[model samples]
Target: MNTILVTGGTGYVGSWIVKGLLDKAYTVRLTVRDKDNTAKFENLRQIALTTKGKLEIWEADLLEEGSFDDAALGCDAILHVASPFTLRFKDAQRDLLDPAIKGTRNVLYAASKSGTVKKVILTSSVAAIHGDTKDMTEQGLTEFNEEQFNQSSSLTHQPYSFSKVEAEKEAWRIAQAQDEWKLVVINPSFVMGPSLSSLSNSESLNFMKDILSGKYAMGAPAIMFGFVDVRDVAKAHILALENENSQGRHLLAERTIDVLEYAQLIEKAFPQKFKLPKKHAAKFLLLMVGWMFKLSSQFIKRNVGYPLRLNASKSREALGLDYIPLEQTVKDMVTQMLDDKLI
Candidate 1:
């Protein structure tokens, strides 16, 4: 069996990828900041036991050079899924951009030096494709695809989107300069589903919690986002790693829905606990809140009431992916939140 190095194997999406890889009987080496933090990775070990695959934890830090070299050695493939993802950030450059861009470079550089590594699957986001909904139509794109990239985002504008764009670009640059490994990027949208671990800190989970907890009690912004199941995202990563023809970027969203529509899905699935937004907040109202909340004011101005479309045909046809329904995805997420007592 080939050994695969999985970065951020204890995270929301990364954990599922580790489980999927283990189910396929791959010897997995998981990288983390602290190898002694058994509580953080114990669940992964439990899952590995059921799958009959081996799990090895290695200490690696994104900021520290040469930290991942030992982990990358002897691995057949690498799944670079570790990146800082947070909505609330004190410094966008320090908190989001630096880690994303630098971490990606470090992983690819290590993979480049590893003679045994053949492929690398990167977990990117739809934020890299188009910064705002308005850019979709402005670019003459009816639906966003892997060929398109975010051009309107900046460190001062939409910092999270900008981070993803820069990181993926860096990955592409590094891959083009090397011949040792092939780079496959999975650009997933807002991923939602049951997490492998009981802990809930993912941005997707936070959004669901806020909705169920009445944070959006008055109304939800009309902003739209593409949604996909976390399981599907993991499966895409696995398929991209194994399939010979799977190269370049794959957009991994099932469909697009507004925030209110998402809230309604959760409320319909779990009526007793989740309170669905009754009204849709006007674009102007969201604009005011965006200013107060320090959200990219440009995001409110561009995406407040627009429909954001993502063309996931490449991932579906190439990887043979059949996306789970948004209703099912939302329900599974709510179920996990309830099981963990987060909601």
Candidate 2:
């Protein structure tokens, strides 16, 4: 029950999960697309060098079926955290849906075949709970929770969110078909904070860079969203693994804030370095300039200025999360990006 395999071990969320497991002295096997890509996982290797936990890397591909069999062998559990989270894609179905759904099937099938896996912790998202911030009111709910499922997003809009919800559905379908392993899901909001690895694949880190580098200096669109620290997301996974009583899905978010507030936090943290936006741009202006930011008027009207609410009571009571302050999260992320010369 001590051996655990983590998919996308080099990713932002997965890397932190690996670090937490290592800190707890658990044997962690990481599956990557390529074992020779040392640059992506060098931080993990250094962690193994300093910790008592044993770390191993194996090759696996999300799109390739049966790719995770070698890594899943002899493992007690799995953390499936690998999935694309990009806005720039030629085809949403090809780039997001196929991999997310097919990838979940691949990993879960691998675990089912392993016959040793006791639990499968799926890294789902708050996106799966609610696609748009303004969705709560229409559904007669004040805040989002584990019971909700995203129904607004599709291939044409918020494709990433659609992928997450669909993937979770597919995982649940696979889990219900067998009794060999139990499934638990961790639905984290927009994850931010320092990365365990110095890799540039994370969209969160990239968003911070854009914020500081004046990408939104001309007044950002007021797209309200929920956010959580990356470390907290990792900790939630650890709690789920240790607490055998824990089951089903849990929502993880420190708080809800808007794009303007986020920029202000960054501005306060780094006084003269970043030219953070002074105000949220007018919705009409955003609509006119939507193409520049790859947004549409409909999206701007739906999300801009709308607040998002998340009820993380389940995670608080079940996973014992005290949560991290957004200010500290912003500061830590900025400092890390500076130290790594990423900005």
Candidate 3:
């Protein structure tokens, strides 16, 4: 069986990827920032106990150079899924950029040192595809696909997206410089589904809680997202590693819809349990009260009423995936959050 290393194995999206790998009977070496924080991985350990796969947790910090060498040694493949993702940050460079760019460099450099690694699968985001939703029309594209790289995001604004683009570009540069290990990138849209742990730091969980907790009681902006399930993202990563032909980048969005549509799906499933947004707030209204939700005025003007689309033929044909429906994804997400008392 292949022994693989999964960075950020305790994260919302990362945990699902770990579970997928274990289901296939692969020996997984997982990295966590704090080995002392065993509470975060209790659910995962429980799953491993019931499965044929073995689990090993190692400590690795993203900022410290060479911190991942111990975990990267002797793995057949490395799934780089650890990156800071947050809109709530005072220092962009401290919180996002340094960790993303420097961390990618450190991890791959460690892989280069590790004599046995054959492939590296990076978990990038559609954020690397474009910064704002309005960029589709501005960039003269009918759909944002693998060919597009976000050029509009900056440190002061859309910093998370900027970090992803820089990290992905750095991965490509590193991969080209070496013939020993190849790189493949999975650029997923908004990933939503059940997380293994309830106390996750994922912005996705926060977004869902805000929706169900009436933060958008009046309404929400008309921004659209190309949505995909968390499990599918993991599946795509494994497929990329297994398929020698799976080179370059693959966009992993199953469908596209606005926040209002997502709200409707949750409402349809959990009818009377929580507050759900019923209408789209006007752009002017969003811009006026943007600070309340941490979204800037420029973001509102550019993306509040724009459309988003992603070409999925590459993922469909190359990964051979049957994606989970957006509606079902939302429903399952809400149910799990409720059961976990996360929302």
Order of the predicted models by TM-score, top scorer first: 3, 2, 1
Estimate, for each residue in 296-322, the C-alpha lDDT of model 1 and write its tens digit: 567788878777889999998999999
Clashing pairs in 3: none
Error of 1 at 90 (Å): 1.3
lDDT of 2 by residue, 1-343 (tens): 6999999778888889999999889999998887898888888989988898989988999999999987898999998988888777899999999999999999999999998999999999999999977788678887889999998899887899999999999999999999999999999999999987676668898788778889888898888878999999999999998889989999998888888898988878778778889988998888899888888677777788776789999999988888999999999988888888898
Indicate the TM-score of model 3: 0.98
lDDT of 2: 0.89
Model 1, position 156, has a per-residue lDDT of 83
Per-model TM values vs. the true structure: 0.97, 0.97, 0.98
Evaluated at residue 132, the lDDT of candidate 1 is: 88
Tens digits of per-residue lDDT, candidate 3, 1-343, equal 2999999888888898889888889999999888898998888999998889999999999999999998888888899999998888889999999999998998898889998898999999999989999899898889988999998899987999999999999999998999889899999999888778878878888889899998887997799998899989988998898898888899998899999988888888889778878899988888889998888988888898877888988999988978999888888888898898786
The stretch of ten residues in a row with the least summed lDDT in candidate 2 is 195-204
Q: What's the true lDDT of residue 238 in model 1? A: 92
